[model samples]
Target: MPAPRIKICGVTQAATLHACIAARADYVGFNFCPPSPRFLSLPAARDLGAQANGRITRVGLFVDADPATIAEAVEAAGLDAIQLHGSEAPQTVAALKARHGLPVWKVISVSGAADLAPAARYAQAADLVLLDAKTPKGALAGGLGLKFDWTLLAAWRPSGPWGLAGGLNPANVAEAVRVTGAPLVDTASGVETAPGVKDMDLIAAFCQAARS
Candidate 1:
């Protein structure tokens, strides 16, 4: 199998973004969730977006945000795509895709085989379905560095494009690919030194390890 594509999420600093580019990460995500420690202000995102304009693919991350909010951010950040980590329905995903004319990724919080059922419904609505760990009650939706049973994905076949996230770090990412056959791998807290602080070395190590 080919090496999985790497996406470094929750990028908050210019240095960190540059590090991802230097490491040849396939995508870079900017968090827009207000509760997230790695949240990016529109102004900051605009600058970062301009900096990364043609050098890399920029994805804006949102959690149940309104259409207007997503629209404004897309313009400010010049995002190539938007990732929704919310309770949005398939119609909502499809509507956003039609409204924005960009790829829309729906995040499915998974704990068991049943959780994978939603992927089929979202296949036509979303450009990609991202399977991530389910957070605790009233907790942050994602980026908590929690992982579910990878074997749960073994028997599951995706209806469309998909990716793996949650608790993936440099140490386990390669094995994650081996088991899940995830064509794309994403990391947020996995490469961080703190809640929102991304370590350059860790980013490099993660990219190398994922492709190793």
Candidate 2:
């Protein structure tokens, strides 16, 4: 099998965008969730997306965003796909896909095997199901840098396309892939110096490791 696709997420600067590109990452994510440290305004996201056009697939990360807001960001940023990191229903995913004419990635937060149920629920509507760690109740979603049990995938089989995320870094991404056989892998905080701060060297190391 080919090496897994790598996505360096939550990019907030032109330099970080370039860093991901230089690492030959397949996808680069821009956060649109305002409360996130990595969140970017529509104009900022648009400019960054423009700068990376044609170099890598641009994914806009949203958390429980409304239709109008999603439409606005899609048009403004020219995103290649939308990653829903919220509790959106399968119907919501389908509606967004139909309305935007772009692929949708649904994030499935996993604390146990039961959490994997939604993957099947979203299989038909979502282009990709991103398996992420479940945050503490009442806490913010994703990029918390917490990892779930990778052993959960030992007997798990997804019904459709999927990506693995959560606390993946250069040191352990190889093991993550070995254990999960994921075709696509995403990381944000793992390569950051701090929340929302991308470190180019770590970005490069991570891509190399994921593709190793």
True lDDT of residue 187, candidate 1? 98
lDDT of 2 at 50: 96
Worst 10 residues of 1 by lDDT: 111-120
Off by over 4 Å in 2: none
Q: Which tens-of-lDDT digit does each residue in 100-194 have in candidate 1? A: 99999999999989999988999989999999999998999999999999999989989999999999999999999999999999999999989
Q: What lDDT does the true structure give each of the candidates?
A: 0.95, 0.93
lDDT assessment of candidate 1: 0.95
Q: In terms of lDDT, which candidate is strongest?
A: 1
Per-prediction backbone clash count = 0, 0
User: Model 2, range 93-165, lDDT digits (tens) per residue?
Assistant: 9999899899999999999988988799999999999999999998879998999999998889899999999
